[model samples]
Target chain A: MTYDWTLWIVFILIGLATTLPRASFIVLGQRATLPEGLQKALRYAPAAALAAIVAPDVVLVGGALEVFNPKLAAAFAAVLATQLSRNPWLPFIVGMGVLWALR
Target chain B: MSPNFREGAREGFRVFLPLSVGLVPWALVTGMTMGGVGFTPLQAMGMNVIVFAGTAQLGTLPLIAAGLPVWLIVVTAFVLNLRFIIFSAALARGFHGVPRAERWLAGHLLTDGVFATCLEKMLSHEDPRWRLGYYLAPSLWSWLLWQVFAFCGVMAAGSIPKGWSLEFMATIALIVLLVPMARLRPMLLAAVTGGTLAVLLRGMPLRLGVIVAIVGGIAAGFAAERWQGKGR
Candidate 1:
C-alpha cells in the first residue's frame, strides 16, 4: 500500500522534533550550565521513561486491571527468564511463549 | 575524518556487539509491525532512516495504528524523545571542545546506549577527539545493523506468523532493558513511581498519561535523591 502523502510531512516534523532535543544541549551546554535541579533530575529520565512505558501495558489489560491478562503473565515470566538466561533474546522468547499460551 | 575515528569506531563497535544482539529484535519487530499496519516497505525504511529512534518510533506506532490524529502522534513521539535532551546535556560537556560540525553529527547519532558507552570512555580517559570517535564509531554500527535487520523484517513480514505475540516480546525486550538500569534506590523509585502512575492514569487522552508518569517519576526520584544527598 502507498503511504498517505501526509505521512511524509509528519515524518519530517518528527525527525526535526526528535533531533532538536538531542542537539540542543549539545550546542548549548557548551556555553552555559543546565540548571542544577534539571541536571539532577535528568538522571532519572531513563528509569522513569522505561517504567512509564512498560508498567501500564503490563499491569493493565483489557482497559482494566486484570491480573490474568496474558501480557502481565508474560511480563513476569520474562523477568524470570532474563535472570536465568542473561541473554536478551531469552526474555522475548519466553514472554511470547507465555503470551501465546495465556492468550 | 580524524585519525582517531577508525580506532574509536572500532572500539565502539566491538564493545557494542553484545548489546546489538539484544537490539536487533526491536528493529526487526518495528519493521514488521510497520508492514502489518499500513506502511509500505519503502515508507517503513524511510521512517527508519529519518526517525532513528526506537522508543519514539515504537511509541508512535500504536497511536498511529489506533487512528489517532497526526498531531497527537507527533507530540507523543516528541515527549518520548525528550530523554534524549538529558542525554545531550550529559554529552555536551564531553563534546564541548570539539568542532560544531562534529557535535552536530554526534547529536544526530546519539542514543542512550551510545551515550553511556561514550561516557564510560570519557570517564576512563580524558581525550575530546577520542571521546567523539568512540561515540560516532559504535553509532555507525548501531545505525547500520538496525536498519538492515529492520528492513529484512519488513520485507519478510508476511511470512512471519501472526499469532507469535511479537509485541509482547517487544514489551519483554523493554523490560529486560529496564531491569538492569533500575539498580539504585533512586532509579528503582523512579521506575516504580512512573509505572504506577501510568497504570493509574491510563485513561488520559492521547496517552498524555505516559508523559505525566515520566515527568512525575523523574520529579519523585529527584526529590528523593535530593533528600538523601546522593544525587549525581
Candidate 2:
C-alpha cells in the first residue's frame, strides 16, 4: 500500500503529454491549418486505432493464434450482427453470449 | 439549426448506455491489475484521474510491472495517445467556434469514443453548439462512469475470476464502435488493414504492433483514397 512518488510524477507528466496533443489545433484557434495530406489522413485514425486494438484480441489465444476458439467465432458473429442490427446492445450480447456458451 | 439541449442529452445517453457495459469490465481489469503491479490504491486512483486513456493506462501496467524506466512509460503513453492529436486535427475545423477553454477541456477528455461520437454527430448535424452539447453530454457520462467503476475495480480486486476474460467485452464495445465508423470505403480499408496487420504483428513486445498497424492502416486508406481520386 506504499505510494510511489515517482510513479505519481510519471502519471502527471504523461497526463500533460497526452492532453497537449489532443487540444493542439483546436486551441490554436481558427486560422490553424494542418498539412492537407495529413488532414485527409487523419480521417483514418479512429478506424485504424480501433482495428489495432480489436484484431489482436480476436485472434490471439494466450498470445498465440487459436483458430477454432469461441472468441474468434463470436467475434465474427458480433461484427455481422453489428452490421444488421439497429440496437447497439445486440452485437455485444450476441458476442459475449457466444463466447460464454462455447467456453 | 441550433441543437436542442434535450435532444443532444438524449442522444448522449443512448450512445453511452451500451458502452457502459464495455467500460465496467475494462475499469475492473485496470483497477484490479494496477494493484498487482505495485501501485498503491491512491496512486492507481491518481493515475485514473490524471491519465484517462484506457489503453495507455493498461499498457502502463505491464511496463511498470517489468520495472521499466519512467522515461519509457512516458514515451509509451505519448506514442499511444498520439492518435488524440489526430482526433483534434480532424475535428478542429468543426470546433473553431468553441472557446479556447472548452476546446482545451475537449482535448483533455478526448478518447476513441468521444472522437467517434463527436465526429459522427458533426458530420450529420453541422451545428457546432449541438455538436459540443452532444459531445459533452456523453463525455461526462463516460468519464464519471470510468472513475466510479475503476474505483470499484480497485476495491474489488481478485474477486473477479481469472477466466472471466472481461477484456473481450471491451473489444466487443470497440468493434461495435468501429463498425459504425467504417461505412465508407476508405474507412473500411483502414479498419481491415489495421486488423490484419495487428494479427500479423501481435507477437511484438509492448504492443509495438499496434503502433505499426495504426500507421500502416492510415497510410493504406489514404493511398486508397488517392487512388480513387485519380480514377474520378
Candidate 3:
C-alpha cells in the first residue's frame, strides 16, 4: 500500500513530541534546573490531568449522569485496591475485570 | 550485557512486572480502537512501537479515525505530549557521562511510569547506576507488553463488542493512580480547577478545552506554590 504523506507527517510529529521531552534533558544537560514553582507545578500535573480525565468518565455515562454505573463501582474497587495494595497494576486489573464482568 | 545494563534491565523488569498485567487491557483497547479506525494491525503495532505514549495515543486516535487532517491529529498529539519534554530534561541531567547511544536508548525507554520511579529515586539520592537500572527495567517491560497486548487487541477486535465500557476501566485505572498523588493542596486545587474548566469549556472546537484545562491547572499550581512560599 502506498504511504500517506499526511499520516506519516502526523506520526513523525507525534513521535518527535514524545521523544523530544525525554531527549531534551540529555541535550540540555545538568545546567538546567527546574524552577521551584515549576517543580511544584509538576507535582500536581499528573493528579490534575488524571482527575480531569477520570471525573467525567465516572460521573457521566452515555452523555448523562449515571451515578450507579457499573464502571463507577469497578472504579471504586480499583481505588480501594490502589490504597490497600499500593500496586498500580492490581487495581487496574481488578477494575477492568469488574468492568468486563459487568459488561 | 554489562553490569549496568543488566542491573538497569533487571530493575526495569521488577518495576514494570506488576504493571504489565494491568497494561494489557489498555493496550488491547488502544489497539482495537486503532484497528477499528481503519489502521491495519501493522500500522497499529508500528505506532505503538514508535510513539509508546498511552494518553497521547488515546487522545489522537479519534481524530485519526474521523479522517481529520493528519496535521491536526499530529498537532493534537504533540501538544498533549509536551509535558514529556520537561520530564526528559529532568532525566537528562543524570545521564551526563553515558555514551551517546546509551542516552538514545534511555530516551527511547523513558515513559511516565519509569520517569516517576526514577524521579523518586533521584530525589532520594540513590546511586546513579542503580537508578538507571531501576528506571530502564520497568519501562522496557512496559514497552514490550504494550506491543504484545496491542497485537492481541488487533487480532480480537472483531470479537469484542462495541461500547464495551472499557473506557471506564481505563479511566478508573487512571483515577486509582491519580488520587494518591492528589493528596497535596496544590494538586487538589489543580484537579478541581482543570476539571471544572474542562467541563465549562467543553463547547470549544478541537478539544481546546483540554488545552485550557491544562493551562489553568499549571497556572493554579504555580500560583499556589507562590502563595505557599510567601506564607512560609
Candidate 4:
C-alpha cells in the first residue's frame, strides 16, 4: 500500500517473474528444442490446466467440496448450454442467470 | 501486410471480439482489488501495465497488503505463472523463425485466453506470418480492453456494489471456453483427470495442485491417445 522504493522494486520483480516464463521457450528458440514426446504432452496440457483451475472454483465452497451448491449447478448448466448452442455468450449468460436465480 | 496476414488478422480480431466480453470483468476486478488493497491509482494502473497478468496480480495483492517480504511474493508469482512455460513451449512451433524482438513482444502480450485460443485454433496453420497476425490481433485487443477497464475499476472501485459477485463471470467465461475444447475424447479424459486432481489436491501449499493436476491430466491424455491408436 505504501508508495515506496521497496514496493516498486517488488513490482518490477513480480513483472519479471511473470513475464520471463512465458518468454522462456519463445526466446530460447533453437537453443532448447523440446523433445517430441514433450511436445506431444504439451498438446493436452492447456485443457488440463484450464480444467484444473475451473474445477476447484466450481466445486469448492468455504474450502469444502459442496457438490449440491449453486456454483456446481450453474457450471453444469453452462456446460449444457455451451454444448447445445455452441455460442460463446449463451453459456455465460445462462450460467450467470442460473447462479443469480439460485442464490 | 500480405493478403494472408490481413485475412488472419481480421479473423483473429473477430473471433476474439466476442470472447473479449469475458475479459473486461476480470480485468476490472483485478483493478478494483488493487484499489481495495489501498494502492494509489497510479500504482494500481502501473501494476496492471507492468505485470499484465491478472492471476498473479490478484494472488500477490493479499501478500503485499499483509506486508510480506518482496522475495516471497515474487517467488509466489513465479510459481503461479509456471503454466506459461508450458504454453510458450507449445506455442514455440508457431514462432519458430520469428525475430527475437518480436518473440519477446509476443510473449509479453500472451494471456490465458489468447494462449488457449491460439493453441486450439491457429497453431496448426502452416503459415507463420498468418499465425503471427492471428496471435497479435487478440493480444492487442485484450491488452486494450484490460488496461482501459482496469483503469476504470481503479477509479470507480468504491461505487461498484460488493454483493454483485461480478467476478463469478470469470468462472462462467472459463467454462464456456473449456467446454468447446473438450469435445475430443482424449481431451475430455485429460480434463476429467485434471479437474479431479485439482479438487483432490486443493489443500496443497503454494497452489502446486494446479501444476500437479496439469501433469497428471496430460499423462492421462497421452495414455488415452496411445490406447486408442493401438486399438485402431
- The candidate maximizing DockQ is 1
lDDT of 1 by residue, A1-103 (tens): 3457888887887888788888887877567556877767877876787787777677775678887777888888888887777665677677878888876
Please identify model 3 stretches exceeding 4 Å from their true place: A1-9, A53-103, B1-39, B59-83, B116-139, B163-169, B228-232
- The CA lDDT at A35 in model 3 is 67
Clashes of 2: 0
Question: Model 3: how far is B182 from its true place, Å?
Answer: 2.5
lDDT of 3 by residue, B1-232 (tens): 5686577667667666775676776787677766655566777777888888777777666556545556556655665555676787677656765667767777866777777766755445345566566666787778888898888977776565555643344465456556676667777788778777766665578767756776787678778867887999
Interface RMSD for each of the candidates: 2.8, 4.3, 4.1, 4.6
Q: Which ten residues in a row have the lowest lDDT in candidate 1 chain B?
A: B164-173
Assess each model's interface with DockQ, reporting 2 decimals per model.
Answer: 0.61, 0.45, 0.39, 0.48
How accurate locally is residue B33 in candidate 4, as Cα lDDT from 0 to 100?
68
What shift in Å separates residue B163 of candidate 2 from its native position after superposition?
Answer: 2.2
For candidate 4, write residues B107-178 as lDDT tens digits.
998898999887855567887778888998999999999999999888876565656554565566556657
Residue B144 of model 3 has an lDDT of: 86
Between candidates 3 and 4, name the one with more favorable lDDT. Answer: 4
**1 versus 2: better TM-score goes to:** 1
lDDT of 2 by residue, A1-103 (tens): 2445677788898888788877787777557767777767877876887787667667777778878888889888898999998765687678978998998
Label model 3 with its docking quality class: acceptable
Candidate 4 docking DockQ? 0.48
User: Using DockQ as the measure, what is the rank order of every candidate, best first?
Assistant: 1, 4, 2, 3
Model 4 earns a TM-score of 0.67
